[model samples]
Target: MKGIKIGEYLVNSCTMYIEPVEYANKIYSHIVEVEEEFLSPFKPLQNIKNSCDYFGVDYESRRKGT
Candidate 1:
């Protein structure tokens, strides 16, 4: 976690964002190792998903105009 810093962390919640001061790959590896303890206890092993709708994918339809 040397080059990694926790950003926009919510207390008592599993949701947290981390920023890397150095290479991104290294940061990802570190997270994978401790994901169980770092993430939700109910489902410790979960696939990471993008929170944004980049490239207009709209996977969750969050930007739908209705």
Candidate 2:
């Protein structure tokens, strides 16, 4: 994001997702890191079911941003 580097890596500018309210009294969105290799819009979502299960997120729920 905006070439924000983590260590020696210059992260490429790319789309990012903001997950909200992961903590108490926090109304702001938090940056959720995406794998650099999967940043391309052309790439399919990796490990769909496992990710959803792990994250406790559903496809349509995520789609609606609810």
Candidate 3:
């Protein structure tokens, strides 16, 4: 498994999910673009609406509200 260095920890590309967490005393979340291989093996945002059955990942939106 390929991984990247983040400060002092090496984050692996094999990620199941990503969520917002406190960083530097701030409550926010963001994704970083790895210039080498790829950001991650799985992209939820793109995959969520990427394809109906592509890559064996079926993402369906059931509700919409704000």
Candidate 4:
């Protein structure tokens, strides 16, 4: 779980968002990158579509106003 610090949070290379919720209140939303290692573990059994299945969010459909 190694990542680079972006502003007050850390963003990995896998395009996942991780940050403190309290500080995030200042902004509408927080978007952070994820690391390959984090994603590599799930690569075998998981299929990553738009947004994260873990969050139950349809990132693509949401962006299209669906």
Clash count, one per candidate: 0, 0, 0, 8
Task: Give the Å error, residue 2, model 1.
Answer: 6.6
* lDDT (Cα, tens digit) per residue for candidate 1, span 1-66: 342332222222353443222243333312323333232221111122233322334444644532
Off by over 4 Å in 1: 2-13, 24-49, 54-66
> For model 2, how does the per-residue alpha-carbon lDDT over 1-66 read when each residue is reduced to its tens digit?
232322111122442553333234333333335643222211123333334556677766765774
> What is residue 49's positional error in candidate 2, in angstroms?
4.6
- Backbone clashes, candidate 4: 8
Superior candidate under TM-score, 1 versus 4: 4
Q: Which consecutive 10 residues in model 2 have the weakest lDDT in total?
A: 3-12
Which residue ranges in model 3 land beyond 4 Å of their true spot? 1-13, 28-66
Q: Which residue ranges in model 4 land beyond 4 Å of their true spot?
A: 1-51, 62-66
Tell me which of candidates 1 and 4 scores higher on lDDT. Answer: 4
lDDT against the true structure, per candidate, is 0.30, 0.36, 0.36, 0.34
Give the per-residue lDDT of model 4 (tens digit) for 1-66. Answer: 333323222222454543222232332123444323222222221233412454576657645774
TM-score of model 3 relative to the true fold? Answer: 0.22
What TM-score goes with each of the models? 0.19, 0.27, 0.22, 0.21
Pairs that collide in candidate 3 are: none
**Model 3 per-residue lDDT tens digits across residues 1-66:** 233423211233543433344445643323343444222233334433433344453344322421
* Candidate 2 colliding pairs, count: 0
